[model samples]
Target chain A: MTAVESSVATLDPEEARRLRRERLERIGSWVLPLAIMVLAIWLWDRICVWNEIPQYILPRPGVVLQTLYNDAALLFGSLLVTLRITFLGLLLAVVGGVGLAVLFAQSKWVEMSFFPFAIVLQVTPIVAIFPLINIYVDNQTAKLLLCAWIVAFFPILSNTTLGLNSVDRNLRDLFRLNGATRWQELWHLRLPAAMPYFLGGLKIAGGLSLIGAVVAEFVAGASGQSSGLASRIIEAGYRLNAPRLFAALILISLAGIVIFLVLSLVSHLILRRWHESALKQER
Target chain B: MVPSTTVPGMEGSGKPLLSLRAVGKTFSNGVTALSNVDMTIREGDFLSLLGPSGCGKSTALRIIAGLTAPTTGTLDWSRKPGEESSVGFVFQEPTLLPWASVFDNVWLPLRLKGVSRSDAAPAVSQLLERVHLSGFENAVPRELSGGMKMRVSIARALVTKPRVLLMDEPFAALDEITRFKLNNDLLELWQDERFTVVFVTHSVFESVFLSNRIVVMAARPGRVFQEVEVDAPYPRDEAFRTSPAYAALCRQASDVLVSAINSTHGAAA
Candidate 1:
């Protein structure tokens, strides 16, 4: 406890307490969520048992999980279909959103003319637009992909535009003084500055893309090899197969979570060295 | 701080690198930032444009750097072909790329001119050493203290070995101790490199300490009010700072600045 002991090798009691508290917090972050999930599942099982609820009305977690294990081939194949749409939608949104945002940054007139159309696409519900998409697109997968892309497109476009436009004024002047071409300025300054915002938009779009795919599948109401989890849920609902419905629902949620975690990891890796948001991690 | 070595001051004997003849700038928003300003910047001269707020001292620096064009009159250049684009600028803030390391920041100008890092390393490192930032090359601007960031900024400016260094209040945001140390270091660098400096600062004492010649400007359609010669020997140090001669020059610049604010003197002076 003496001040003389604070030379280099050891921490004082206060420092030790802080370190212990930090470690506890890190552990609790993951453990608490998992514990709560287990507790919730137990409570759910107990309620079903206590009431003698029929499995058809509200299947127990065990029933749903068992259904998942037994029908792994069907469920996994459907999950891959939904995941394909999510990833492809996300990819198209990134390419189209960033490409348009760059054009917007370059020419104000182009942005002024087209930005309102983008807003229109964002504001209109995908449900309402499906009729038009249904008429125009013959392919079911194309319709689902288009719907997903539309949902995920807005955030990337807006955030990247904001980042590109918000360049430091003095740095812009410095670039001009050096007689930098517009291409060089965009490559060296705007794009790099816009990276954090683009990554932020990417995180939001990742989750949204999955949601869009699920919603599109629900609306399609098609049943087949590539109809995805939502359609499988629909098929289970008409037949009153609650376990299969719950299993499909759980698969969709898991897929969304995995997408979010992967996108967040990418963002962290890209920004950890230089960005203000990432620097706070202190790793 | 380095010891003051004997220096044969340029004493305005160097040829005119560029001249601003009746230059004026009116912003697109209908603000006349500068009016009929005339200046002859000579090679190797330490010149300060001294003024109050809204005096367009910064506009003048921007004009020299060609960041902004003059609305009226001419900026004639006499520099040879290879040196035409050789102007280094430092802003009021460090204005560094937050993502770049100190070394990469210093290598920016050369990079713009198509020099690879391997090609630019010796210049960047030597300048970093001169700025006392050799050990901090890998640190980002956020990791650095204020003075260290400014040192990196200065190193970036000098890395290209510019013929004219245009600094707009580069040390105004810094603390007194850092300012003094930077001032002493800047004097040594100017003496060693002999680059023309058109420094924009409002501080009377700072102007007297660093500049061989000071141009006092008046605001409200900013124009030159008066010019004062420090006429001090080169390699100015802390000893010169405390000397009566330095005090006299400061007092003289302060008087010109006072009249400039009061607008009591005509532009002819």
Candidate 2:
């Protein structure tokens, strides 16, 4: 037999080609929605620019592009500031969320005690709580941290709690019969099994962190001298510099997209090898 | 189980390797899965716990393997005064860890006992060969066929080298051809290993073919209905399966099963 033929003896080329065609078609299906979005954005940008609507009301894509270029240094500095808080808040959320989830999973009393409060936090708007948190913490940075934490904590806590509690009874018994200590069971079985759920929570928390950072920045701008993309947008709007505001908005959108992609990549890389949901193809 | 002829309790004057003293199991949910199940398993004896579903066959096997605590019985095991291991269990489902490769799955019991992978590798590899699964050390459970998965489970059970092997309907889920092949392979493996086997099965023919003795059980507050002794010779083959003696034993076993069914619900047609 030919080398290629022998290598794929169990695999039929015609069938594989058919499957590839189907899979490629499925990937190609994303093209239409992307095209529609691009077309709509471009058309809206053109119409706004043509209408000679006040620049402050709605900046044209070209004007926004110019503003981004002109204010590159200041914009990037603010971008870094926003990213720092977003990432730090995310780190804190994961640590607090997963740690609490482990505790809650281990005890019904802990879950009952804390889960309602977590739900209450989740439901309470971060914007409404920002001023209060600012008062309690007594620092601009601390207030921002508290606000962002409120926004980002719930998803990770809920997802991880579910993950930790949802271990297979058979697997638990297997560990018990094998003479594994409770600590080993948790470190090995509970942790690994909870990973997919934790990653799932992380993906949600990732996006929420960016939103939290932006919102906290907005509230911070409303209160004091600290300024970020939200403040820049507000300042540009007040000054009738629509291009700069558009630039800030564009940056915020980019941040959200970046967080989505980065967390998605992390989740996929960690879980695709074993988990069915993240897996793109069968081995 | 190596060197084949060393019967555990009956071997060379050692105490009985494993014994069940009036074993009974009643679930907290009011299900009496087994009751007053008295059994003495000698070394190298092929004993089948034969019964229908809910007959406590699996329950009995589980109790022997120490996977489940009997509600009203004590297990007597003499581990040669120094042997730490007592019994090994092969579950009905292949129960191979989906994430671990075949070698790793088989190495679990040994690994749990503080044996390094390298130290356990030779023993695990030898076990793979014993189960006719060489060169498949790296294959995962998802990569294996049903029969192959069951073989891996069997291999995992045998890796610890326990005196008694408790198999709970290990081949019940396999296709007829695969089941027959595995049955013969199991007997061959048993011959080589010489561990006392407590095999659970629902098939009359299978029990007749494999076991030195078959304990038939009745369901619903499960209890032993009767015991049948097979006087068949060793090294039984396909010819033996088709033999008049085997058919007669099967018929006798079936009669006992029907009688038990009749005693229970008058459903033994």
Give one digit per residue, the lDDT tens place, for model 1 in A120-188.
999999988977887899898899999999999899999999999989999998888777889989998
Per-candidate Cα lDDT values, in order, are: 0.88, 0.81
Off by over 4 Å in 1: A1-24, A223-225, A281-283, B1-8, B81-85, B264-269
Best by TM-score: 1
Looking at model 2, residue A3 earns an lDDT score of 88
Number of the top candidate by DockQ? 1
How many clashing pairs does model 1 include?
A: 0
The 10-residue segment with the lowest total lDDT in model 2 chain B: B1-10
Cα lDDT tens digits for candidate 1, B1-269: 12122235444437778899999999999999999998888877888999999999999998888888899989988867676657899999999999889998898888888899999999999999999988898998999999999888888888878889999999999999999999999888888888889999989999999988888999988888888877788778899989999998888889989989888345443
Candidate 2: regions farther than 4 A off? A1-27, A281-283, B1-15, B266-269
**TM-score for predicted model 1 compared with the true structure:** 0.93
